[model samples]
Target: MDFLYLLKERFLPLSLMAIIPIISVILLIAIWKKKDQVSKMMLTFVTVISLILLISSLVLMLFTLVIGYNS
Candidate 1:
């Protein structure tokens, strides 16, 4: 019961953090394989957006951790 509670609380932030790296890897691989300039540019844009999301998620996780700790 306690473990389940802990997992439930931490799952969202942790999963977000975990999934970004996988997405980034896939994006990078796609970018590597793609030959067209337009497609590459689009993939690059998406990659940048994913990186921004990852950073924001990290910030959110940290904020949550700090808030949880202080409270």
Candidate 2:
């Protein structure tokens, strides 16, 4: 089907975008379990980084959807 073909074409970028949320979830879980100030601070820093990544990924995805790729 046409939809399937389109999905295949966009799979790589979409999958890459998906990875950020998965990582963010794992980081959040780690943060919840962590207790020490030092470790918690470190995990918080990493979680912030993941948040930035998620935002950038969203922007990139939107841009790609609007502008599309060269055929």
Candidate 3:
């Protein structure tokens, strides 16, 4: 039971990381299937959100690298 708990604690972050790509793929499929104006708009919104997330993650990663190097 203790081992399971420890595993879960370690796995939680990894699971969350895995979700981002799944969500991105689902959003891409939705965008591809979208035909009407509202759907297209929603798809565009999702694309923007995904791009923002990508950029933010990249910036954070770069910051972490810089900080790590300085330390």
Candidate 4:
């Protein structure tokens, strides 16, 4: 599928990067819901990890666009 190819082209990592925010949101809700598995420590960890991922993805996207990507 063409979608698979798109992911293969480095967007896979971007997708992963994007998912972190969603996960964070879920964790936030879980915290409010008093889920046993979701804790403040876990949220803090994921938040840091997501920040790193977001920055990396942004840098990569900028770099890719600068170099040019074939349609």
Q: Which candidate ranks first by TM-score, i.e. highest?
A: 2
- CA lDDT of 36 in candidate 2? 61
The Cα local distance difference test for each model comes to 0.66, 0.71, 0.58, 0.60
Q: Candidate 1: worst 10 consecutive residues by lDDT?
A: 62-71
RMSD of each: 5.0, 3.4, 7.7, 6.5
TM-score of 1: 0.49
Error of 4 at 58 (Å): 0.8
Q: Mark the regions of model 4 whose C-alpha exceeds 4 Å error after superposition.
A: 1-37, 68-71
* lDDT value, residue 70 of candidate 4: 61
Q: Alpha carbon lDDT of residue 21, candidate 2?
A: 71
Task: Quote the positional error of residue 63 for candidate 1 in Å.
Answer: 0.9
- Residue 54's lDDT within candidate 4 is 60
Candidate 4 yields a Cα-based lDDT of: 0.60
* Model 4, span 1-71: residue lDDT tens: 75556556757455655665566566555555664666778767766665666666567655654453566
User: How much lDDT does candidate 2 score?
Assistant: 0.71
> What TM-score does model 4 achieve against the real structure?
0.44
Q: Against the true structure, whose lDDT is highest?
A: 2
TM-score versus the correct structure, for each prediction:
0.49, 0.58, 0.47, 0.44
Local accuracy of candidate 2 as per-residue lDDT tens digits, 10-69: 777877777777777777677767646557568778778878877887777766554566
Residue 70 in model 2: shift from native, Å? 4.4
